[model samples]
Target: MAKLVLTRLGGTLKGRALTPNPLPRILWRSLSTEGESQDPSIDPFLHSAPEGLAFGRLTGIGRNTLKTDVIHYLEGCKLSINDVKFDYNRAYTPVGVLLQFPSRSSFDLAVRQTIRKGRLYKLEKIDRSEWDLKTSYDGKAVLLQGVPRNALQEDVERFLSGCNFDPSSFQTFVRPGFPDPIRVAIIQFPTQVDAMNAFCVKNRSFCLNNPISMRVLQ
Candidate 1:
């Protein structure tokens, strides 16, 4: 039988029957003098979820630390759990755990993130002869990296207006803060160097180590 034990610290000990299967339940507890603060080792609860497990939570220093510990623990257990967390804020570097999830889940998460995150705009793919821009010039869509606070849609529009391509055809993405959403923008440039330059200058916040390919409709 599933047992649901609902407890709000200092409030009530409400108990509801729950399934025997191991799903999850919320255990709210008042900040007791003894458990006032979580120990770094036991923090972020996800680590305690059992080996070869998966979950999510609010992001913070403690959460991050917990993640590290969880990874180490998993390694010790000879287990690999798929980790997934939303980056609505876009502030957290989408590395480590971000790269750990299943590939399909990662792609779906990214698409959903693009929808709820923020306003999307188009930017030009500037090309310098140094990098490969052939694909971008072929009218294929490309991804640009940027941060929300720093991205100027107008500036991007104006810069791309003079280029051979239509500025309105592409989209711009700046990493937003917590609860915002994760997104990647698409654009077409004459060469890879231009695409790279724009990405570096605009999407500096993402710390994106590699560029993603875009499929241009036009």
Candidate 2:
């Protein structure tokens, strides 16, 4: 985004200057917190999602934007929307949106229209190939690294439930990633004990398989 400053002198506009706007404090803090919050020993690329496209990423918009927000903005512009459909994707750097357009021609048309008419915030076509590198944890979710991008959602969940970690208590949200060699995931256990076992400890070593702190379980 650009910052515009209008100089007013003697009740008359003197000149106008435009410059790049600085990133907001809150957003910067969140990105910076990624490293601070995660375990330093866990490699950034270690548990990265290789298949990458778990969710589509869109640019030229705020990370927190919702589908209705875009629809309302477009409606204000009196734009036609009979041919387009979209959804909100996960938040990422710069900005991102999850969009599901019906056709390629419609997608391309949207690109041109948004660029030309969207004077405030431009909307980019939703793409499936782009993925997010910001993987997050709630401290105890079992982390599974080296996942294949082509793996099915069911398969991923099944793997987590069937792992060495006790599966009886495994009833939670299994989602994820980072940008390393392959895909990464978590087992979504309800308790630390359920995520731990003979595999988790040996000779006073903790290996819960998660890259995050797990509440300093290390």
Candidate 3:
């Protein structure tokens, strides 16, 4: 009869044949568990925000803070925040949060807005706190060149309908030396998302007698 060798039975093949090593099952399992623990996915590497993405920080965050509270606060302020990626704890325990925004304009607006203290979410300020804006913007206004000098404000607004742009926000600028009758019109939108959507009208026919080109300034 074969003798029990740790977790399995071991028998000699013939006379003087050596038995298999008698390693304990617990030890074997421990080695396998250690291998699994070394998986790269569970690594504790500290990652920073990637390039081209706007980043911001919110302090005084608690473990009890819910994602819903953050969403509600953002929507309440009409912030066109979209596709925001979050990292709760860059450390062991929950300290605060880091936010990454795909939309630079949205990030600019959000960091400038005041977030009032609510039931669950708390901040250092008793009344309110502004999200720390860590990025800069060259500009967000749309510039339309070669606009017909004769086009009225009402005519421009009609062509820019559904773009959420304020009718009174369009301004015309003309170079003093250049004698070209064409004028440049700069239009501003309420939110960054609106500015993004403003590009959808690029192909739409703006004038019948004049040539015009539009571009969103960085």
Instruction: Indicate which candidate wins on TM-score.
Output: 3
Candidate 2, position 168, lDDT = 43
Q: In model 3, which runs have C-alpha deviations exceeding 4 angstroms?
A: 1-139, 176-181
Q: Please list the residue runs of candidate 2 whose C-alpha ends up more than 4 Å from where it truly belongs after superposition.
A: 1-57, 74-94, 122-218
Clashes of each: 27, 7, 0
Worst 10 residues of 3 by lDDT: 122-131
Clashing pairs in 3: none
Tens digits of lDDT, candidate 1, 1-218: 66678877778677777667666788987656774665666666865654332222222223223333434533322224234222223333322222132333433443354344452311111222212211212213344443233445564454444434346656665555356644545566665455545544544332223333322211
- Residues 136-185, model 3: lDDT tens digits: 11124566666677788777777777778777777887633255544777
C-alpha lDDT score of every prediction, in listed order: 0.39, 0.42, 0.51
Order of quality (TM-score)? 3, 2, 1
177, model 1: CA deviation in Å?
7.6
Weakest ten-residue segment in model 1 by summed lDDT? 121-130
The all-Cα superposition gives candidate 3 an RMSD in Å to the true structure of 18.9
Report lDDT (Cα) of residue 86, candidate 1: 21
